[model samples]
Target: MISGSIVALVTPMNADGGVDWAALERLLELHIEAGTGAIGAVGTTGESATLSVPEHCEVIKFCVDSVAGRIPIMAGTGANATREAIELTRAAADAGADCCLLVTPYYNRPTQRGLYAHFRAVADAVDVPQILYNVPGRTAVDMDNEVVAELATHRNIVGIKDATGDRERGRDLIARCGDEIAVYSGDDPTAMDLMLAGGKGNISVTANVAPRQMAQLCALATAGDREGASAINELLTPLNSALFLEANPIPVKWAMAQQGLIGEGIRLPLIVLDEQYHADVRAALEAAGV
Candidate 1:
Protein backbone atom coordinates (compact mmCIF):
# COMPACT_ATOMS: atom_id res chain seq x y z
CA MET A 1 0.00 0.00 0.00
CA ILE A 2 2.49 2.67 -1.11
CA SER A 3 0.61 5.95 -0.84
CA GLY A 4 0.79 9.68 -0.03
CA SER A 5 3.33 12.26 -1.24
CA ILE A 6 5.95 10.02 -2.78
CA VAL A 7 8.61 12.36 -4.19
CA ALA A 8 10.13 11.75 -7.62
CA LEU A 9 13.53 12.93 -6.37
CA VAL A 10 16.04 14.78 -8.52
CA THR A 11 19.56 13.35 -8.73
CA PRO A 12 21.91 16.04 -7.53
CA MET A 13 24.92 16.87 -9.74
CA ASN A 14 28.07 18.97 -9.21
CA ALA A 15 29.48 21.68 -11.53
CA ASP A 16 31.72 19.07 -13.17
CA GLY A 17 28.69 16.89 -14.10
CA GLY A 18 29.35 14.05 -11.69
CA VAL A 19 26.78 12.31 -9.52
CA ASP A 20 27.22 14.17 -6.21
CA TRP A 21 26.75 11.33 -3.75
CA ALA A 22 27.14 13.65 -0.74
CA ALA A 23 24.38 15.92 -1.99
CA LEU A 24 22.19 12.90 -2.78
CA GLU A 25 22.67 11.64 0.79
CA ARG A 26 21.66 15.02 2.16
CA LEU A 27 18.57 15.11 -0.09
CA LEU A 28 17.54 11.62 1.01
CA GLU A 29 17.98 12.59 4.67
CA LEU A 30 15.98 15.77 4.13
CA HIS A 31 13.05 13.90 2.55
CA ILE A 32 12.99 11.28 5.32
CA GLU A 33 13.06 14.01 7.94
CA ALA A 34 10.41 16.07 6.16
CA GLY A 35 7.95 13.14 6.14
CA THR A 36 7.99 12.28 2.44
CA GLY A 37 5.89 9.13 2.07
CA ALA A 38 8.29 7.49 -0.40
CA ILE A 39 11.33 8.29 -2.59
CA GLY A 40 11.75 7.45 -6.32
CA ALA A 41 15.10 7.80 -8.05
CA VAL A 42 16.01 7.72 -11.80
CA GLY A 43 12.48 8.63 -12.82
CA THR A 44 11.89 11.44 -15.31
CA THR A 45 12.79 13.92 -12.59
CA GLY A 46 16.09 12.14 -12.03
CA GLU A 47 17.11 12.31 -15.74
CA SER A 48 16.87 8.57 -16.31
CA ALA A 49 17.20 8.68 -20.11
CA THR A 50 20.52 10.50 -19.98
CA LEU A 51 22.08 8.22 -17.37
CA SER A 52 24.03 5.10 -18.31
CA VAL A 53 22.96 1.71 -16.91
CA PRO A 54 25.71 1.68 -14.28
CA GLU A 55 24.82 5.18 -13.14
CA HIS A 56 21.17 4.16 -12.87
CA CYS A 57 22.00 1.16 -10.70
CA GLU A 58 24.43 3.24 -8.64
CA VAL A 59 21.76 5.87 -7.94
CA ILE A 60 19.22 3.25 -6.89
CA LYS A 61 21.77 1.51 -4.68
CA PHE A 62 22.86 4.80 -3.16
CA CYS A 63 19.25 5.76 -2.32
CA VAL A 64 18.60 2.37 -0.72
CA ASP A 65 21.80 2.58 1.34
CA SER A 66 21.26 6.21 2.35
CA VAL A 67 17.66 5.73 3.46
CA ALA A 68 18.62 2.67 5.55
CA GLY A 69 14.99 1.60 6.03
CA ARG A 70 13.85 5.05 7.18
CA ILE A 71 11.41 5.13 4.21
CA PRO A 72 10.31 3.10 1.20
CA ILE A 73 12.40 3.69 -1.96
CA MET A 74 10.74 3.02 -5.34
CA ALA A 75 13.47 2.92 -7.99
CA GLY A 76 12.59 3.72 -11.61
CA THR A 77 13.52 0.63 -13.62
CA GLY A 78 11.48 1.18 -16.77
CA ALA A 79 12.75 0.77 -20.35
CA ASN A 80 11.37 0.37 -23.85
CA ALA A 81 12.64 -3.18 -24.02
CA THR A 82 11.00 -5.84 -21.84
CA ARG A 83 14.30 -7.62 -21.27
CA GLU A 84 15.93 -4.36 -20.23
CA ALA A 85 13.09 -3.57 -17.83
CA ILE A 86 13.42 -6.99 -16.23
CA GLU A 87 17.16 -6.58 -15.88
CA LEU A 88 16.86 -3.15 -14.27
CA THR A 89 14.08 -4.34 -11.96
CA ARG A 90 16.13 -7.34 -10.90
CA ALA A 91 19.03 -5.02 -10.14
CA ALA A 92 16.74 -2.79 -8.07
CA ALA A 93 15.49 -5.79 -6.12
CA ASP A 94 19.10 -6.78 -5.53
CA ALA A 95 19.91 -3.22 -4.47
CA GLY A 96 17.16 -3.57 -1.81
CA ALA A 97 14.62 -1.12 -3.23
CA ASP A 98 11.19 -1.72 -1.75
CA CYS A 99 9.56 -1.51 -5.20
CA CYS A 100 10.11 -0.39 -8.79
CA LEU A 101 8.20 2.16 -10.89
CA LEU A 102 7.89 0.83 -14.45
CA VAL A 103 6.90 3.47 -16.97
CA THR A 104 5.15 2.53 -20.22
CA PRO A 105 7.38 1.61 -23.18
CA TYR A 106 8.53 4.80 -24.87
CA TYR A 107 8.93 5.38 -28.65
CA ASN A 108 8.25 1.74 -29.39
CA ARG A 109 4.48 2.15 -28.86
CA PRO A 110 3.61 -1.39 -27.88
CA THR A 111 -0.02 -2.54 -28.23
CA GLN A 112 -2.35 -3.13 -25.25
CA ARG A 113 -1.56 -6.83 -25.45
CA GLY A 114 2.09 -5.93 -25.65
CA LEU A 115 1.68 -3.66 -22.63
CA TYR A 116 0.13 -6.54 -20.64
CA ALA A 117 2.87 -8.93 -21.68
CA HIS A 118 5.54 -6.34 -20.87
CA PHE A 119 4.31 -5.67 -17.32
CA ARG A 120 3.47 -9.33 -16.70
CA ALA A 121 6.97 -10.35 -17.78
CA VAL A 122 8.61 -7.97 -15.30
CA ALA A 123 6.25 -8.91 -12.48
CA ASP A 124 6.92 -12.57 -13.10
CA ALA A 125 10.69 -12.13 -13.42
CA VAL A 126 11.27 -9.84 -10.42
CA ASP A 127 10.69 -10.81 -6.81
CA VAL A 128 9.60 -7.33 -5.73
CA PRO A 129 6.56 -5.05 -5.75
CA GLN A 130 5.89 -3.25 -9.05
CA ILE A 131 4.00 -0.06 -9.78
CA LEU A 132 2.82 0.72 -13.33
CA TYR A 133 3.60 4.22 -14.60
CA ASN A 134 1.19 5.48 -17.35
CA VAL A 135 2.40 8.89 -18.41
CA PRO A 136 1.63 8.79 -22.15
CA GLY A 137 2.80 12.36 -22.53
CA ARG A 138 6.36 11.27 -21.97
CA THR A 139 6.26 7.67 -23.17
CA ALA A 140 3.90 8.39 -26.08
CA VAL A 141 2.13 5.13 -25.34
CA ASP A 142 -0.89 5.26 -23.11
CA MET A 143 -1.59 2.19 -20.99
CA ASP A 144 -5.36 1.93 -21.31
CA ASN A 145 -7.55 1.30 -18.28
CA GLU A 146 -8.41 -2.16 -19.49
CA VAL A 147 -4.75 -3.05 -19.80
CA VAL A 148 -4.14 -1.75 -16.30
CA ALA A 149 -7.05 -3.76 -14.96
CA GLU A 150 -5.61 -6.83 -16.64
CA LEU A 151 -2.22 -6.25 -15.05
CA ALA A 152 -3.76 -5.67 -11.60
CA THR A 153 -4.43 -9.40 -11.31
CA HIS A 154 -0.71 -10.11 -11.09
CA ARG A 155 0.48 -10.64 -7.53
CA ASN A 156 3.56 -8.46 -7.79
CA ILE A 157 1.91 -5.73 -9.87
CA VAL A 158 0.59 -3.93 -6.83
CA GLY A 159 -0.28 -0.40 -7.98
CA ILE A 160 -0.13 2.36 -10.57
CA LYS A 161 1.12 5.97 -10.85
CA ASP A 162 -1.72 7.55 -12.87
CA ALA A 163 -0.46 10.75 -14.50
CA THR A 164 -3.32 10.81 -16.99
CA GLY A 165 -5.02 13.60 -15.01
CA ASP A 166 -8.37 12.38 -16.27
CA ARG A 167 -10.74 12.26 -13.34
CA GLU A 168 -13.39 10.25 -15.16
CA ARG A 169 -10.83 7.64 -16.21
CA GLY A 170 -9.28 7.59 -12.74
CA ARG A 171 -12.69 7.23 -11.12
CA ASP A 172 -13.60 4.45 -13.53
CA LEU A 173 -10.41 2.57 -12.77
CA ILE A 174 -11.04 2.93 -9.06
CA ALA A 175 -14.56 1.72 -9.49
CA ARG A 176 -13.58 -1.34 -11.52
CA CYS A 177 -10.34 -2.27 -9.80
CA GLY A 178 -10.87 -0.84 -6.34
CA ASP A 179 -10.10 -4.05 -4.50
CA GLU A 180 -7.13 -5.01 -6.69
CA ILE A 181 -4.99 -1.95 -7.36
CA ALA A 182 -3.92 1.08 -5.36
CA VAL A 183 -4.20 4.11 -7.63
CA TYR A 184 -1.76 6.98 -7.07
CA SER A 185 -1.83 10.35 -8.77
CA GLY A 186 1.38 11.21 -10.64
CA ASP A 187 0.14 14.64 -11.69
CA ASP A 188 0.45 17.40 -9.09
CA PRO A 189 -2.26 19.75 -10.37
CA THR A 190 -5.11 17.25 -9.97
CA ALA A 191 -3.72 15.29 -7.03
CA MET A 192 -6.21 16.57 -4.46
CA ASP A 193 -9.13 16.00 -6.76
CA LEU A 194 -7.91 12.49 -7.52
CA MET A 195 -7.54 11.70 -3.81
CA LEU A 196 -11.04 13.02 -3.18
CA ALA A 197 -12.20 10.69 -5.93
CA GLY A 198 -10.63 7.69 -4.11
CA GLY A 199 -6.95 7.85 -5.10
CA LYS A 200 -4.55 6.69 -2.39
CA GLY A 201 -1.97 9.47 -2.82
CA ASN A 202 0.32 11.35 -5.19
CA ILE A 203 3.70 10.45 -6.72
CA SER A 204 4.41 14.15 -6.77
CA VAL A 205 7.00 16.23 -8.62
CA THR A 206 6.07 19.27 -6.48
CA ALA A 207 7.00 17.40 -3.32
CA ASN A 208 10.71 17.65 -4.17
CA VAL A 209 10.76 21.30 -3.12
CA ALA A 210 7.79 21.40 -0.72
CA PRO A 211 7.64 17.99 0.92
CA ARG A 212 5.96 19.06 4.14
CA GLN A 213 3.25 21.01 2.35
CA MET A 214 2.70 18.26 -0.24
CA ALA A 215 2.54 15.63 2.48
CA GLN A 216 0.06 17.75 4.40
CA LEU A 217 -2.10 18.18 1.32
CA CYS A 218 -2.15 14.44 0.60
CA ALA A 219 -2.89 13.71 4.25
CA LEU A 220 -5.74 16.18 4.34
CA ALA A 221 -7.22 14.91 1.06
CA THR A 222 -6.92 11.28 2.09
CA ALA A 223 -8.45 12.00 5.51
CA GLY A 224 -11.47 13.78 3.96
CA ASP A 225 -10.21 17.22 4.94
CA ARG A 226 -11.22 18.82 1.68
CA GLU A 227 -11.25 22.36 3.06
CA GLY A 228 -7.79 22.07 4.55
CA ALA A 229 -6.39 20.42 1.44
CA SER A 230 -7.94 23.04 -0.81
CA ALA A 231 -6.41 25.90 1.19
CA ILE A 232 -2.95 24.37 1.09
CA ASN A 233 -3.28 23.50 -2.59
CA GLU A 234 -4.18 27.09 -3.39
CA LEU A 235 -0.88 28.15 -1.86
CA LEU A 236 1.02 25.48 -3.81
CA THR A 237 -0.70 25.76 -7.20
CA PRO A 238 1.72 28.36 -8.54
CA LEU A 239 4.82 26.41 -7.60
CA ASN A 240 3.32 23.31 -9.18
CA SER A 241 2.59 25.10 -12.44
CA ALA A 242 5.89 27.00 -12.62
CA LEU A 243 8.02 23.90 -12.00
CA PHE A 244 7.06 22.86 -15.54
CA LEU A 245 8.16 26.09 -17.25
CA GLU A 246 10.61 23.77 -18.96
CA ALA A 247 10.63 19.99 -19.16
CA ASN A 248 10.46 18.55 -15.58
CA PRO A 249 13.76 18.46 -13.65
CA ILE A 250 15.19 21.41 -15.51
CA PRO A 251 12.86 23.79 -13.69
CA VAL A 252 12.75 21.59 -10.58
CA LYS A 253 16.55 21.59 -10.36
CA TRP A 254 16.44 25.34 -10.75
CA ALA A 255 13.88 25.58 -7.93
CA MET A 256 16.16 23.48 -5.73
CA ALA A 257 19.16 25.68 -6.48
CA GLN A 258 17.04 28.70 -5.44
CA GLN A 259 16.50 27.06 -2.06
CA GLY A 260 20.22 26.10 -1.99
CA LEU A 261 19.20 22.42 -2.01
CA ILE A 262 21.54 21.47 -4.90
CA GLY A 263 24.00 23.01 -7.33
CA GLU A 264 22.81 24.50 -10.66
CA GLY A 265 24.61 21.96 -12.83
CA ILE A 266 22.24 19.97 -15.10
CA ARG A 267 23.43 17.35 -17.61
CA LEU A 268 23.98 17.92 -21.34
CA PRO A 269 20.96 18.04 -23.81
CA LEU A 270 19.04 19.46 -20.78
CA ILE A 271 20.47 22.88 -20.07
CA VAL A 272 20.00 25.00 -16.95
CA LEU A 273 16.75 26.95 -16.55
CA ASP A 274 16.71 29.79 -19.02
CA GLU A 275 17.41 33.18 -17.42
CA GLN A 276 14.03 34.48 -18.59
CA TYR A 277 12.06 31.99 -16.45
CA HIS A 278 13.93 32.82 -13.23
CA ALA A 279 11.66 35.65 -12.08
CA ASP A 280 8.53 33.57 -12.59
CA VAL A 281 9.90 30.57 -10.70
CA ARG A 282 11.27 32.80 -7.93
CA ALA A 283 7.92 34.54 -7.55
CA ALA A 284 6.19 31.17 -7.39
CA LEU A 285 8.63 30.08 -4.67
CA GLU A 286 8.04 33.25 -2.70
CA ALA A 287 4.29 32.85 -3.10
CA ALA A 288 4.58 29.34 -1.68
CA GLY A 289 6.94 30.74 1.01
CA VAL A 290 9.77 28.39 -0.02
Candidate 2:
Protein backbone atom coordinates (compact mmCIF):
# COMPACT_ATOMS: atom_id res chain seq x y z
CA MET A 1 0.00 0.00 0.00
CA ILE A 2 1.42 3.39 -0.97
CA SER A 3 0.82 5.43 2.18
CA GLY A 4 1.14 8.97 3.59
CA SER A 5 0.55 12.18 1.57
CA ILE A 6 0.24 11.16 -2.04
CA VAL A 7 0.05 14.44 -3.93
CA ALA A 8 -2.60 14.59 -6.65
CA LEU A 9 0.08 16.21 -8.81
CA VAL A 10 -0.61 19.13 -11.10
CA THR A 11 0.68 19.03 -14.68
CA PRO A 12 2.66 22.25 -14.91
CA MET A 13 1.99 24.03 -18.18
CA ASN A 14 3.50 26.82 -20.20
CA ALA A 15 1.50 30.06 -20.52
CA ASP A 16 0.16 28.77 -23.85
CA GLY A 17 -1.06 25.55 -22.19
CA GLY A 18 1.74 23.19 -23.08
CA VAL A 19 3.03 20.75 -20.45
CA ASP A 20 6.07 22.28 -18.81
CA TRP A 21 8.44 19.37 -18.53
CA ALA A 22 11.17 21.25 -16.67
CA ALA A 23 8.76 22.66 -14.11
CA LEU A 24 7.27 19.21 -13.62
CA GLU A 25 10.74 17.84 -12.82
CA ARG A 26 11.12 20.60 -10.24
CA LEU A 27 7.78 19.71 -8.65
CA LEU A 28 8.69 16.03 -8.56
CA GLU A 29 11.92 16.91 -6.81
CA LEU A 30 9.90 19.01 -4.35
CA HIS A 31 7.74 16.04 -3.36
CA ILE A 32 10.64 13.59 -3.29
CA GLU A 33 12.64 15.87 -1.02
CA ALA A 34 9.60 16.30 1.19
CA GLY A 35 9.38 12.54 1.78
CA THR A 36 5.98 12.35 0.10
CA GLY A 37 4.84 8.73 0.08
CA ALA A 38 3.67 8.72 -3.53
CA ILE A 39 2.50 10.76 -6.48
CA GLY A 40 -0.89 10.72 -8.30
CA ALA A 41 0.17 11.89 -11.73
CA VAL A 42 -2.40 13.21 -14.22
CA GLY A 43 -5.19 12.89 -11.67
CA THR A 44 -7.99 15.42 -11.29
CA THR A 45 -5.63 18.04 -9.99
CA GLY A 46 -3.54 17.32 -13.04
CA GLU A 47 -6.54 18.32 -15.20
CA SER A 48 -7.12 14.83 -16.51
CA ALA A 49 -10.30 16.03 -18.18
CA THR A 50 -8.41 18.38 -20.43
CA LEU A 51 -5.31 16.44 -21.42
CA SER A 52 -5.36 14.52 -24.68
CA VAL A 53 -4.96 10.74 -24.37
CA PRO A 54 -1.41 10.80 -25.67
CA GLU A 55 -0.60 13.70 -23.39
CA HIS A 56 -2.00 11.84 -20.39
CA CYS A 57 0.11 8.79 -21.14
CA GLU A 58 3.12 10.98 -21.71
CA VAL A 59 2.74 12.64 -18.32
CA ILE A 60 2.39 9.33 -16.52
CA LYS A 61 5.42 7.96 -18.31
CA PHE A 62 7.34 11.08 -17.49
CA CYS A 63 6.49 10.78 -13.80
CA VAL A 64 7.39 7.11 -13.70
CA ASP A 65 10.70 7.81 -15.39
CA SER A 66 11.51 10.81 -13.22
CA VAL A 67 10.72 9.09 -9.95
CA ALA A 68 12.75 6.05 -10.98
CA GLY A 69 11.06 3.75 -8.48
CA ARG A 70 11.94 6.01 -5.58
CA ILE A 71 8.25 5.96 -4.57
CA PRO A 72 5.03 4.51 -5.87
CA ILE A 73 3.23 6.34 -8.70
CA MET A 74 -0.56 6.08 -8.93
CA ALA A 75 -1.52 7.21 -12.43
CA GLY A 76 -4.94 8.73 -13.01
CA THR A 77 -6.49 6.34 -15.54
CA GLY A 78 -10.21 6.86 -15.05
CA ALA A 79 -12.51 7.82 -17.89
CA ASN A 80 -16.21 8.07 -18.60
CA ALA A 81 -15.63 5.47 -21.29
CA THR A 82 -14.78 2.00 -20.03
CA ARG A 83 -12.56 1.17 -22.98
CA GLU A 84 -10.70 4.42 -22.54
CA ALA A 85 -10.15 3.71 -18.86
CA ILE A 86 -8.80 0.27 -19.67
CA GLU A 87 -6.46 1.69 -22.29
CA LEU A 88 -5.16 4.35 -19.92
CA THR A 89 -4.71 1.78 -17.17
CA ARG A 90 -2.76 -0.41 -19.55
CA ALA A 91 -0.65 2.54 -20.59
CA ALA A 92 0.06 3.42 -16.96
CA ALA A 93 1.03 -0.13 -16.14
CA ASP A 94 3.27 -0.26 -19.19
CA ALA A 95 4.76 3.05 -18.17
CA GLY A 96 5.68 1.43 -14.83
CA ALA A 97 3.11 3.06 -12.55
CA ASP A 98 2.82 1.24 -9.25
CA CYS A 99 -0.99 1.47 -9.47
CA CYS A 100 -3.91 3.19 -11.13
CA LEU A 101 -6.60 5.47 -9.66
CA LEU A 102 -9.92 5.06 -11.47
CA VAL A 103 -12.62 7.59 -10.73
CA THR A 104 -16.30 6.69 -11.13
CA PRO A 105 -17.69 7.54 -14.57
CA TYR A 106 -18.88 11.12 -14.42
CA TYR A 107 -21.75 12.92 -16.28
CA ASN A 108 -23.12 9.55 -17.30
CA ARG A 109 -24.77 8.47 -14.08
CA PRO A 110 -24.48 4.72 -14.00
CA THR A 111 -26.66 2.69 -11.65
CA GLN A 112 -25.06 0.66 -8.88
CA ARG A 113 -24.98 -2.38 -11.12
CA GLY A 114 -23.53 -0.39 -13.98
CA LEU A 115 -20.93 1.08 -11.67
CA TYR A 116 -19.91 -2.38 -10.51
CA ALA A 117 -19.71 -3.67 -14.03
CA HIS A 118 -17.78 -0.64 -15.28
CA PHE A 119 -15.14 -0.93 -12.56
CA ARG A 120 -15.03 -4.71 -12.73
CA ALA A 121 -14.45 -4.65 -16.46
CA VAL A 122 -11.45 -2.38 -16.01
CA ALA A 123 -10.03 -4.41 -13.14
CA ASP A 124 -10.44 -7.61 -15.09
CA ALA A 125 -8.89 -6.17 -18.21
CA VAL A 126 -5.87 -4.71 -16.40
CA ASP A 127 -3.57 -6.79 -14.25
CA VAL A 128 -2.21 -3.86 -12.26
CA PRO A 129 -3.55 -2.92 -8.82
CA GLN A 130 -6.46 -0.46 -9.01
CA ILE A 131 -7.81 2.03 -6.50
CA LEU A 132 -11.46 3.10 -6.83
CA TYR A 133 -12.15 6.82 -6.54
CA ASN A 134 -15.59 7.94 -5.27
CA VAL A 135 -16.09 11.69 -5.45
CA PRO A 136 -19.84 12.16 -5.79
CA GLY A 137 -19.44 15.90 -5.73
CA ARG A 138 -17.54 15.62 -9.01
CA THR A 139 -18.90 12.39 -10.51
CA ALA A 140 -22.63 12.93 -9.74
CA VAL A 141 -22.72 9.17 -9.20
CA ASP A 142 -22.54 7.97 -5.63
CA MET A 143 -21.09 4.47 -5.22
CA ASP A 144 -22.66 2.81 -2.21
CA ASN A 145 -20.39 1.01 0.25
CA GLU A 146 -22.07 -2.23 -0.72
CA VAL A 147 -20.85 -1.69 -4.27
CA VAL A 148 -17.38 -0.89 -2.94
CA ALA A 149 -17.37 -4.01 -0.76
CA GLU A 150 -18.29 -6.11 -3.77
CA LEU A 151 -15.53 -4.47 -5.80
CA ALA A 152 -12.99 -4.89 -3.00
CA THR A 153 -13.06 -8.65 -3.37
CA HIS A 154 -11.25 -8.51 -6.70
CA ARG A 155 -7.58 -9.37 -6.20
CA ASN A 156 -6.52 -6.43 -8.38
CA ILE A 157 -8.95 -3.99 -6.77
CA VAL A 158 -6.75 -3.16 -3.82
CA GLY A 159 -8.05 0.17 -2.46
CA ILE A 160 -10.59 2.98 -2.61
CA LYS A 161 -10.21 6.75 -2.29
CA ASP A 162 -13.40 7.77 -0.46
CA ALA A 163 -13.91 11.53 -0.91
CA THR A 164 -17.42 11.56 0.51
CA GLY A 165 -16.33 13.47 3.65
CA ASP A 166 -18.99 11.55 5.57
CA ARG A 167 -17.02 10.29 8.54
CA GLU A 168 -19.71 7.84 9.64
CA ARG A 169 -19.97 6.42 6.14
CA GLY A 170 -16.17 6.21 5.95
CA ARG A 171 -16.04 4.41 9.28
CA ASP A 172 -18.69 2.01 8.07
CA LEU A 173 -16.76 1.36 4.87
CA ILE A 174 -13.56 0.80 6.86
CA ALA A 175 -15.32 -1.67 9.13
CA ARG A 176 -16.77 -3.47 6.14
CA CYS A 177 -13.69 -3.66 3.91
CA GLY A 178 -10.53 -2.30 5.53
CA ASP A 179 -9.28 -5.86 5.89
CA GLU A 180 -9.88 -6.49 2.18
CA ILE A 181 -8.74 -3.16 0.73
CA ALA A 182 -7.02 0.04 1.82
CA VAL A 183 -9.28 3.09 2.15
CA TYR A 184 -7.69 6.47 1.47
CA SER A 185 -9.15 9.92 2.14
CA GLY A 186 -9.60 12.19 -0.89
CA ASP A 187 -11.20 15.03 1.03
CA ASP A 188 -8.43 17.12 2.57
CA PRO A 189 -10.30 18.93 5.34
CA THR A 190 -11.67 15.69 6.79
CA ALA A 191 -8.59 13.61 5.96
CA MET A 192 -7.17 13.50 9.49
CA ASP A 193 -10.37 12.18 11.00
CA LEU A 194 -10.56 9.51 8.32
CA MET A 195 -6.92 8.46 8.85
CA LEU A 196 -7.47 8.26 12.61
CA ALA A 197 -10.51 6.15 11.79
CA GLY A 198 -8.19 3.72 9.96
CA GLY A 199 -7.87 5.25 6.50
CA LYS A 200 -4.56 4.26 4.97
CA GLY A 201 -3.57 7.74 3.73
CA ASN A 202 -4.61 10.86 1.88
CA ILE A 203 -4.72 11.45 -1.92
CA SER A 204 -4.28 15.13 -1.35
CA VAL A 205 -4.57 18.49 -3.10
CA THR A 206 -2.95 20.49 -0.29
CA ALA A 207 0.20 18.47 -0.65
CA ASN A 208 0.74 20.11 -4.05
CA VAL A 209 1.78 23.27 -2.16
CA ALA A 210 2.76 22.06 1.29
CA PRO A 211 4.16 18.62 0.61
CA ARG A 212 6.46 18.47 3.64
CA GLN A 213 3.75 19.56 6.06
CA MET A 214 1.10 17.27 4.60
CA ALA A 215 3.58 14.38 4.64
CA GLN A 216 4.30 15.04 8.32
CA LEU A 217 0.60 15.17 9.16
CA CYS A 218 -0.11 11.88 7.39
CA ALA A 219 2.79 10.14 9.16
CA LEU A 220 1.64 11.40 12.56
CA ALA A 221 -2.01 10.54 11.96
CA THR A 222 -1.33 7.07 10.58
CA ALA A 223 1.02 6.39 13.50
CA GLY A 224 -1.96 7.12 15.79
CA ASP A 225 -0.36 10.34 17.05
CA ARG A 226 -3.50 12.44 17.25
CA GLU A 227 -1.97 15.38 19.08
CA GLY A 228 1.03 15.58 16.80
CA ALA A 229 -1.07 15.09 13.70
CA SER A 230 -3.76 17.50 14.81
CA ALA A 231 -1.18 20.17 15.49
CA ILE A 232 0.03 19.88 11.88
CA ASN A 233 -3.53 19.60 10.58
CA GLU A 234 -4.46 22.78 12.43
CA LEU A 235 -1.68 24.65 10.65
CA LEU A 236 -2.82 23.20 7.35
CA THR A 237 -6.58 23.67 7.92
CA PRO A 238 -6.69 27.07 6.19
CA LEU A 239 -4.61 25.81 3.24
CA ASN A 240 -6.88 22.79 2.87
CA SER A 241 -9.94 25.05 2.67
CA ALA A 242 -8.31 27.71 0.52
CA LEU A 243 -7.16 25.31 -2.20
CA PHE A 244 -10.79 24.55 -3.00
CA LEU A 245 -11.90 28.17 -3.03
CA GLU A 246 -12.54 27.78 -6.74
CA ALA A 247 -12.51 24.32 -8.27
CA ASN A 248 -9.24 22.43 -7.53
CA PRO A 249 -6.03 23.22 -9.38
CA ILE A 250 -7.32 26.73 -9.95
CA PRO A 251 -6.54 27.89 -6.43
CA VAL A 252 -3.84 25.31 -5.88
CA LYS A 253 -2.03 26.06 -9.11
CA TRP A 254 -2.19 29.73 -8.21
CA ALA A 255 -0.72 29.02 -4.78
CA MET A 256 2.15 27.09 -6.30
CA ALA A 257 2.75 29.84 -8.87
CA GLN A 258 2.81 32.39 -6.06
CA GLN A 259 5.51 30.34 -4.41
CA GLY A 260 7.38 30.39 -7.78
CA LEU A 261 6.98 26.65 -8.12
CA ILE A 262 5.11 26.76 -11.46
CA GLY A 263 4.06 29.21 -14.08
CA GLU A 264 0.56 30.66 -14.62
CA GLY A 265 -0.99 28.22 -17.05
CA ILE A 266 -4.30 26.30 -17.02
CA ARG A 267 -6.54 24.86 -19.72
CA LEU A 268 -9.73 26.24 -21.21
CA PRO A 269 -13.04 26.17 -19.21
CA LEU A 270 -10.76 26.48 -16.16
CA ILE A 271 -9.14 29.85 -15.86
CA VAL A 272 -6.70 31.25 -13.32
CA LEU A 273 -7.82 31.89 -9.77
CA ASP A 274 -9.86 35.06 -9.29
CA GLU A 275 -8.31 38.15 -7.72
CA GLN A 276 -11.06 38.33 -5.09
CA TYR A 277 -9.99 35.08 -3.46
CA HIS A 278 -6.27 35.82 -3.79
CA ALA A 279 -6.00 37.42 -0.37
CA ASP A 280 -7.93 34.62 1.27
CA VAL A 281 -5.67 32.00 -0.28
CA ARG A 282 -2.56 34.00 0.47
CA ALA A 283 -3.56 34.48 4.09
CA ALA A 284 -4.29 30.78 4.31
CA LEU A 285 -0.84 29.96 2.92
CA GLU A 286 0.76 32.36 5.39
CA ALA A 287 -1.29 30.97 8.25
CA ALA A 288 -0.27 27.45 7.28
CA GLY A 289 3.33 28.71 7.09
CA VAL A 290 3.61 27.36 3.56
Candidate models: Cα lDDT each: 0.92, 0.96
The total number of steric clashes, by the backbone 3 Å criterion, in model 1 comes to 0
Q: How do the residues 219-281 of candidate 1 rate in per-residue lDDT, one tens digit apiece?
A: 999888899999999999999999999999899999999899999878999999999999999
- Give the poorly placed runs of model 1, Cα more than 4 Å off: none
Query: After aligning candidate 1 to the native by TM-score, how far in Å is the CA of 160 from where it should be?
Result: 0.4
Candidate 2's TM-score: 0.99
C-alpha RMSD between model 2 and the true structure: 0.5
Off by over 4 Å in 2: none
Worst 10 residues of 2 by lDDT: 1-10
> Candidate 1 has what TM-score?
0.98
Clash count list over all predictions:
0, 0
Q: Spell out the clash pairs found in candidate 1.
A: none
- What TM-score, over all chains together, does every model reach? 0.98, 0.99
Question: Candidate 1 at residue 184, lDDT?
Answer: 92
